[model samples]
Target chain A: MPTRTPMEVSIAVAKAVQQADVDVIAAYPITPQTHIVEHLSELVANGELQAHFMNVESEHSAISAMVGAAAAGASTFTATSSQGLALMHEILFIAASLRLPIVMVVANRALSGPISIWNDHSDIMAERDIGWIQVFCETGQEAYDAILHAFRVVRDPNVVLPMVVNIDGFNLTHVIEPIYLFEQEELGDYLPEHRQSLKLDIDHPITMGPVGIPEVYTEAKKQVEDALINSKQVILAAWQEFGRRFGRAYAPIETYRVEDAQILLMTMGVISRTAMGAVDRLRDAGKPVGLIRCRLWRPFPLPEFREAVRQASIIAVIDRHISLGAHSGPVGQEVRSALYTLPNRPQVFDFVLGLGGRDVTVHDFLEIVELAEQYATQGPPESEYTLIGLREV
Target chain B: MAEKVEKRAIIGWRNLALGCAILEPGSSMHLLTGTWRLQRPVVDPEKCNQCGLCHIYCPDLAMTKTAAGTYEPDLNYCKGCGICAEECPKDAITLVEEKE
Candidate 1:
């Protein structure tokens, strides 16, 4: 039996990584993401977790160290935030292309301009094409569970790619919630030992990440692309098994009150909980409003998403990050593309809100639904994407 | 490694190994980069003096120290960068343009 304990989400994430029995953890301290590695360092020092906790100088070296450790047949882990994640941009592609299953947790935060240490999806949105398996978490329990699931999925023989479990920086990482902690013994056959077949060994020499000249570069890239695309089934299977063992099921696209609904609000990360509340209030007021929370960000989960919003007349995609000149937010852009070929597709109205830790109340969600409905009937808005609550100076 | 096959016969993306990692050890020896060389290093054993500087300075590990205290350059693997010729005190090694 697992013990339910109230703990900060970051510490719970660290505990989950500890429970995964990671061999190497390389990280640089950054706001919101620091507590996770800080706790892991303490655990290692107190003999609670037996692992090499390296306090690297920068996020670039942190990820680089993880790459070396992972390729050398170690279950490696790391965590970072906005600027740290940006610094790791160059090696991020290298980690994915080299097929190293180095699991990471990104405390999603806003990018620097005015320099804010607040929460948003801007950090990870910049890394949309990094080729790693990326997932968003709604709560502390989900973030904890995701860390465990990430190690299992990435280390799988077929899907030996790196993974990132994104928990909204201050929103999710700094919050305290009741998370059920599991014992390593009870994990039993669920997460088996990570044995990388093609690892660097002195006895058995094998060259990894060798130069792929023009003759082989395309093929090598195609392999990574195919691997990510093919990992959908593997991801689903892992989720199903996790549900069967833990009794809490997770899906790529989680829907709320979508039955016979005309308006659907789509969201990701912790804000989905607030969206659900708005959905409930709207339902109580005799409105046909529904909510869709996208748990799986990368690999898109296009078929599942289409099925989720097929019945709705309008989809108001709420994004924490704006794509600047692209007019629509990143999620909104993807939703439009995914629904482009569908028959009688729903109209997608993108709303970029809650940037730099700006508060988004349920009232804001209600307003968004109204705006989306208005746009649906009155053609499109002046701007394809509406920046909600921007005070006009 | 498996009988120098034609480039056209290279395996497709589906058949390529994971991450395109070379699973076979010492597989690079089959590439024979010596074909890329424009000049070849020639050693005059008479002035060689058994200094072994060529063996130390050769970037490609192409120079072998003979049992008779002289160094010989293996033209099959050497790219003829002339590093060995430049470093040799006796100047016994010289870079000559390859004929065909």
Candidate 2:
């Protein structure tokens, strides 16, 4: 049995990579995500983990190097956040389209205009359509386990796609929590040696990423889209196998006390923990309320999400990022679209909050629930989304 | 005919992503680019000294040595770049307008 140790999530992530025994790590230091690659560098330096740790100049070079490493048949990994992730935007698509099974941990942070290094989903949300398997972690333990699972999921032959595991910046990344650390032997049983049949080898001499002219561009895109959409099965299989092996189960949409509830609060990342507290208070006060934490953000888990909120009449979606000028927040828009065709769908109220590391307390969640209830009865407010907890000058 | 071959190339694969990738290096040789030429280079055998200067300077690798030890330009793959004609010391190659 693996021993439970209290440590920072960043350390746990590095330890998971160590256990997986990745072949290459190309990373540049970025705030919140720095500790993960720093610890990884230490592990490599100490000879505890046998991997090539390339300290690159920038995040773009880091990701570009990983693309080359992955193409060369190496199990590659990297970590970045915020501006770093933005810098790697162009290469992110190429990595996915080439079907490189590289795993990345993105410490989700707000994109800067005012230059705030804080926790939010804007960073990863801006990259939602980059064609990688994206998963969000709500706790330190999830962050640890998800990294291991990401390797297994991405390396699956049926789903040869890159994966991004999003951990809220400074919230889960810097927090210390008790997590079960897996033994290297046990990890060997779960994740085997990565052997890609199609790779850049001198003996085979293959050319990857060729020009797709007008006659072939659509088919190439369809191939990538189909691979991403079809990867959901492999994702679920990996989670199930992990549960059976490690005794901790995970789901795409994890619900908390949703049975017979009239109103549900949907959230992602660490805010879901706070929302659970609000649900407890609302439940104790004789109000039937529930919470649903969205774990898998990409390949968007449509069927599971629709079923999770099917019984609720009103759903308050707490978005940590704003999709300016859109009808609602990113998650809100996705949820509404998923449930649009249902005969008796719930009314979704978009509440944008906690941008730039603003605190979202139980009181705020309670207010959001009340406002959502009002919107349900009053047929929505004038605006598509309401910005909560904003101070008026 | 090149368009037909390109269409066949696009549809002949089971997996488009893997198929779109050129698994064999230098496979672009299979793609006939000769039709891209508006003017073709004609070798002047009478004026040609077997110096192989045009063969050495052909950008497309279209010029080849024949069994008689004379250099000839393979028009099937040549793009009519006129580099060989311009570089031939013996004036052994000339570019003529290709007509339908």
Candidate 3:
């Protein structure tokens, strides 16, 4: 809303980062993510944001710089896209293990052998288990808002871990929408201004990053699990607080009109907007269909997901990334895994819809709903993974 | 008769030296003399497996050898960080706690 330009969404987030009073940032420019940190760098250079914005040599070093900065007890941030995020893979795990609570924005883009600089969820899918709360946004507004939510989530005592906000590289990151620029004072109330809980103290010089022996190794991993498990609650609390302060609502798994619906459609990232439109059409035509838009991915919201789709006869998931030779697509696989143990679990199916920035119109989503209807009457298996929109090339 | 209370203290090892299990005086004093005590690793040929893992992993070549090729821990100058013992695959050299 600041300016009509789609790039302003990223700028809004930059302002939020400025307002958040980040102490350090290490960024390397790549498409879709370039404008974000570019504005961030300008903010730092213009004396608007008093922070060390280190322009690193590689994305690897960019994350490495933030890691070192965060470990030394500074609120750190970085933004990157497909190849850049891929390059920072090894250091990503290190950032989480060190409990740095760094925030990053991944302009959700497809990975390459063909080298397409387009939007998809592949890049994030590659690093899902690197121990970060991954949030996907459907609009530029959500993208900006999720940045604040990410900071709150990562910095919370229950979840002292790094977080990534995946905005659709071309769709959400490059789309203009009315995003309310949050006031710093309001943000202070919603998102607490607690600095690092613990950091490098020279008086008590303890060796951080020490090699863990077998005796302490499992305990170290167990601590991370406990913190991450508690993150689900912290994530919801962050969203609720965001809603309270800003009058904008969010959920880990946001359901659209599923109270008495028989069939449900599932989606994530920017595609959920298109899917929601399709669900509205289906509902008007007397099809008992609804939408489940997963706003949060990591520390996957299992209980909420089961409750959202409990009464629904079928749950058709639209995945933007393909996990080749696997059970199904990434989001599709996880959705099933979450609901499989339930006594009255819905018959879940996969619809591997879009990739490399494929345009998934509302009609494509309608096709998914229709397919779910057919499978519902036929009494489908425990679950099935069926890609909806791929003609064998 | 009151039980005689002896005001004496003795520190000793709980494990015996079996085969090549040498628990030389005391080792693993990382908290105390890590910066002061120096003990380079020495390997007894009768027990070593010539694993070469220790040679490769030693950050400081404090884990070196004598002229005849049996590994000797140079204690006079070694920082006694015990990185060598931590890396030794064969577990041949037991660090004698060089008193600080």
Candidate 4:
């Protein structure tokens, strides 16, 4: 139809979530991501949407409100950015293990020391292991599609896990692109009604958050793990169904021009588009190169990753968040672990780049490839973490 | 008077959709055999200061204090979610599964 802006994408997301019948809205406002909450607030204020808008005092409370609502048998949604997301750390893990299907939109922004209001994965990175079904979006349409599929994944009978659909803070959150909007009737047909056994009830109340001992403690964690691991099948089925309706399919790891590549570039977030451009340039010049976009970050599709990297000899992983003095960057460490556990693995390496939305140009992409080619023959460097996009002293 | 609706997903409709309800509606024992017998929160009278962390954190609000300053749990309301035992700063509570 017509062109759309990042704000339009978020509006579409809110509307679609509304169409999907989200019963509760909990969120805090911050730059870059501020438009999402601001617009959603207008919809609620104008009586365009019917849901409890928990204008929580903090990101922590925003998350907690959703947690409470989800337990109350409401399909809940929330949004946040940067340090606001960091505030929700404690409850994010709780939401996943408790198996309450709360869907959230995180306008990915950088954590501050220097006060950045730009696009970066630092916000989502800090929460890598919080056990939510994480989806990274490259475009506005992807952002809209991710929210719909996330609802299906998060609420699946087997995979009652919360989900976070993240788009790069200002880059995607503030930018504009046309979205393939869904009709309310079609959205309802695709997403079923909120259906969880009333985990909360006043008449016959049951405890929501409880303490566990050694005996049941392991089982609690085990149940979550089993649910998360088992969710793989259900997640794929939902995505397939989503594609059937939305006309776009998202894989855990999507490949670009890697059929017979000499080097592979692995990354996430909006930067993948730039890396793909590098892939094309390298390919045109007869330098076999491919790029893999990690769309699903948590409950990492290990099998698919293992399969994707099996053919490549040298792989370079670019991380948007740093572990700080750690062996590898967050996503890099995850990639290494996944590949190491696989029977057929590649010589995977990683670098920390674009923290606080630092610009990572095509030249930087070449530097990553140079390192990958070096590792292809010499093996992984002695030290794991390499800081890229930093000016040498 | 409270009205109730059957939880279709929790009690899967596939079987019902296939025209097999064994009994129409209330003919079967839906009150699960041992759900009530499992892990009741036991309070340690000697250690309990009755600070009420247990009462507040209990998801179901199963704990309440009497006018005499003694805390007690309403077994009818406590599904043994264990938040009480876990949140009790003094380790004043324990949960053990019971048969009766």
Candidate number of the best TM-score: 2
Misplaced by over 4 Å in model 1 are A1-3, B1-4, B26-100
| Tens digits of lDDT, candidate 4, A1-393 | 334443466676676676666888887887777777777778888987887787889988998898888887899988888889988999998998777899989998888878888777888887877878888888788888788788877777767788898988877777677676766765756786778854677675555555443434555666666677777788788888877766678788899998987578998878888898888888888898999888877778988988888788778999888787788888888888777756767777888888887887888898889877876677667788678877787
DockQ, candidate 4, vs. native dimer: 0.04
Predicted candidate 1 versus true structure: per-residue lDDT over A1-393, tens digit per residue: 567899999999999999889999998999979999999999999999989988899999999999999989999999999999999999999998989999999999999987989999999999999999999999999999999899889878999999999999989999999999888777777776899988899998888888887767899999999999888888999999999988989999999999999999999999999999999999999999999999998888989999999888999999999898897999999999999987789899999999999998999999999999899998899998999989999
CAPRI-wise, candidate 3 is incorrect
Give candidate 2 misplaced runs (Cα > 4 Å).
A1-3, B1-8, B17-19, B32-100
Task: Please give the ranking of all candidate structures by DockQ, highest first, separated by commas.
Answer: 1, 2, 3, 4
Where model 3 places Cα greater than 4 Å from the true spot, the runs are A1-7, A378-384, B1-100
Interface RMSD, one decimal, each candidate: 0.9, 2.4, 15.2, 12.7
Alpha-carbon local distance difference test for all models: 0.91, 0.89, 0.76, 0.76
Indicate the worst ten consecutive residues by lDDT in candidate 3 chain A: A204-213
Evaluated on the second chain alone, the candidates' TM-scores are 0.77, 0.78, 0.49, 0.60
Model 2, residue A62: displacement in angstroms? 0.8
lDDT of 1 by residue, B1-100 (tens): 3236333335689877787888876666655566678888888889988878788778888999877878887766898899998999998988899887
Chain B alone, model 2: TM-score? Answer: 0.78
State which docking tier applies to candidate 2: acceptable
Error of 2 at A104 (Å): 0.7
In model 1, what lDDT does residue A78 have? 97
Model 2 chain A worst lDDT window (10 residues): A212-221
**Which stretch of 10 consecutive residues in model 1 chain A shows the poorest summed lDDT?**
A183-192
Model 1, residue A84: distance off in Å is: 0.2
